[model samples]
Target: MAHGDITHIDIPVGDTQAARTFYSGLFGWDIAEVPGFEGYPMWRAPNQISGGGLAPRDASFTTPRSYVEVDSIDDTLAQVSSLGGKVLMGKSQISPTSWWAIFEDLDGNQLGLYEGVTSAE
Candidate 1:
């Protein structure tokens, strides 16, 4: 299960339009519905690059399991702290780039920033 990198992530919220508006207005992100995923908006990162998604908080909620792959979980955790975030879960191996953890930023926004790979990365 050595994930080369965190390919994508999904966040579940109760509202789509409000969620979209919040992200779009706050971060200037360009969000669009992923072609095949009905009601799921793929969130664009800064500079208009696709980063992840904002989806419905259904009973089958699954977006909480976001990921942040890293070369070294310890180092990444350190960086998270340096960047004003607190690790909620200590690093746990999911295999190489597949390891994971949770953290809260200074704003108390919970996010999982994984460092992994792409075919080209």
Candidate 2:
């Protein structure tokens, strides 16, 4: 995906199994737990292109968070700070090739940023 495109979303749920069943039954999404990600079950929509994880709900993660694809998390976080936004989380690794971060906008809406390198590269 290109920069600024929404690549992933995280839905906070109290019950992973219930949420998986509800989403899969309601939207025909394929929800499953991938290896190495035991508690976090990922769900892929019928379209197959759109997918995200169902994270355990917490005080800090009470709502859905959409992750925007970015070229660089460092640069984007800098821009966000310059624009009066606050970085809630610093860049964290998902894998060797990917990283994610979270920031709160001026309006206090939290959003996530994703930076990944595809194997094709």
Candidate 3:
């Protein structure tokens, strides 16, 4: 993926199991629980091309948010600020090399940014 490309998406749900069952059966998506991410399960589309996560819903994060891939999280954040957007979450690591962050556009819609290896060697 490249900068501006949607890398991942996070959909908030009240019930993890029920959401998993609904999505898995509805779309035949492969939704499975990740080891460390217990209640939050990752989902892959039927084509097995697009992927994202099904997360527990909360007051501040109840809607589905898409993540755009960026080469540099810091740089992109700076650009976001310059473009009148606000950082809702600072760059944080999901792994040693992978990182993610959330932000709000001028209209207040929340979105995410992803920085790391997007493909396997």
- How do the residues 1-116 of candidate 2 rate in per-residue lDDT, one tens digit apiece? 89999988999999999998899999999998887678998888889889899999999999999999999999999999999999999999987898999999999999999999
**What Cα-based lDDT does every candidate model obtain?**
0.69, 0.92, 0.89
Of 1 and 3, the candidate ahead on lDDT is 3
Task: Give TM-scores for every candidate, taking all chains together and pairing residue i with residue i.
Answer: 0.47, 0.95, 0.93
Comparing 1 with 3 on TM-score, the higher-scoring candidate is 3
- Tens digit per residue, CA lDDT, model 3, 9-99: 8999998889889989998989887776777789999877798999889999889999999999999999999999999999999876789
Candidate 1, run of 10 with poorest lDDT: 112-121
Highest TM-score: give the candidate number. Answer: 2
Q: Once superposed on the true structure, which residue ranges of model 3 sit more than 4 Å away at CA?
A: 118-121
- RMSD per prediction, one decimal? 7.7, 2.3, 2.0
Give me candidate 2's TM-score against the actual structure.
0.95
* Top-lDDT candidate index: 2
lDDT of 1 by residue, 3-119 (tens): 335545778889899999998899888888854456877776885444777868987464554555556767878988998889888776534444556777798766665554332
